[model samples]
Target: MTFQLAACAEMLWRDRPIDWRASRLKELGFGVGLWNWPAHDIAALERTGATFTIMNGYLQGRLADDEGADMLLKSARETAAVGKRLGVHRLNLHGTGLGDGGIPVWQHDKVTGPMWLKARDTLNRICDLAEELGVTYTLENLNLMEHPGCPFNTTADVLTLVSSVNRPQLRMNLDLYHTQIGEGDVIRWCQKCLPWIGEVQVADNPGRNEPGTGEMNYPAIAKALKAMGYSGPVGLESNAEGDPEVALQAFRNAFTV
Candidate 1:
């Protein structure tokens, strides 16, 4: 079986329009991961004959409060609408940012319990919307050091969220970059998190650059996922070490199964 690779559009080809990003990646025989893109540009993306696999929907919001969780639900609804129209199935959202008193939502706090419950409710409702819209809502994990105050940090935490929600439409986006930083042993981590993983994002550890620029063994990571029967697109979500094309070439060479 063949798996796909999606380039993080915003992280590459800075000298062109949003539509051109996909076209350029297509020229390199690559797909794209969408973020901060307008729904109007979907036609332009389609014109490039590009493949769009995952889109970042909501980045920051409180999941525990009624007002905040409502905001997230509304945002997710809008994102699902746009993504469904564009034929994109995966809509990735960060669980939470920071809460009151500048405390992380995933950490011990006064409102953690209530907020967690609310996050659960909000995600479940979003899953309902996503199921109806023929889309999937993937909760993405971030690192504690890099993304301070990020709610979903550990791989286990993200897995717990998906398991707790218990919705077919709700899943996990295992960003290996963050995992490498927060929790090492990516190959084993990938295996453990395989069941709930709906999307995958990659970047080298130590430095958030292309695969070959840092300490990560891209070939091994790729091979591990493939061996586990994961056929979903693995997104290269990092800045180029030098030229984007060269970076892509290195990735292609290293990550091929």
Candidate 2:
């Protein structure tokens, strides 16, 4: 895969000046990832000459009755509409939590069972809306260490969701840092899920900071990605230690693609 560095808007909007961020990203040849921005801010992003690779679709419990699910879906559609207007394509979504009741059968039980069937139905509905809006929806695997409630924490979880949804546009966003924390074998898991992989986020392990700062062997990871025939952006969704340029340079050296 041709690697592309993408800055997450979360830290940029917090520590750095916004205008400087746009200019820096343009100079560094990086794309952008919109986390949680208002509509007007999204409009402003369109003017920055940066392509949005993916976005936060929704944030709530995964259960059917969660009010946040509906609200997030509405917001996801609106955000995706804005992204389409700006020539962006992928939208990232989180999985449901294991409520006080228990983990859903889809995550903990057989994939062909009734509970999973219901979850697949809900995912299909969401995928249908995403298709109508002309955007690809990618379900992300979160780190259980960071997010204990996240149901889809392993590559198996992601695989099951993709297989159950069984739609061309429904894919998975493989975050390397999360994989390191949540799965026993990251490279093997990537190989197994290659067909369903869509967008990818990369950062070193332990700190979720730039590569070389933490324990992840990014060069091996990049090679593994290429071996799996992944030809997409390796989004830089980590924190910069000193200057953003330092992190950018580290990414360039590590990937060397």
Task: Quantify all predictions' global Cα lDDT against the true fold.
Answer: 0.77, 0.69
For model 1 the TM-score comes to 0.89
Misplaced by over 4 Å in model 1 are: 38-43, 97-111
Sequence-dependent TM-score of model 2: 0.85
Model 2, residue 208: what's the lDDT?
75
- All candidates: CA RMSD (Å): 3.3, 4.3
Task: Estimate TM-scores for all models.
Answer: 0.89, 0.85
* Model 1: per-residue Cα lDDT at residue 217: 93
Instruction: Please report how far candidate 2 places residue 72 from its true position, in Å.
Output: 4.5
What's the lDDT for candidate 1? 0.77
Candidate 2 lDDT by residue in tens digits, 1-257: 26666767555535665545655676777777765445335556667777667776653335333353565567667767666866766777766633333233224322335545555666787788887877788888876666655555567877888877779878888887888888758788888888888877888877778889988888888887876777777778877756767887888787765
Positional deviation of residue 15's Cα in model 1 after best superposition, in angstroms = 1.4
Give the least accurate 10-residue stretch of model 2, judged by summed lDDT.
Answer: 101-110
| Model 2 score (lDDT) | 0.69
| The best candidate in terms of lDDT | 1
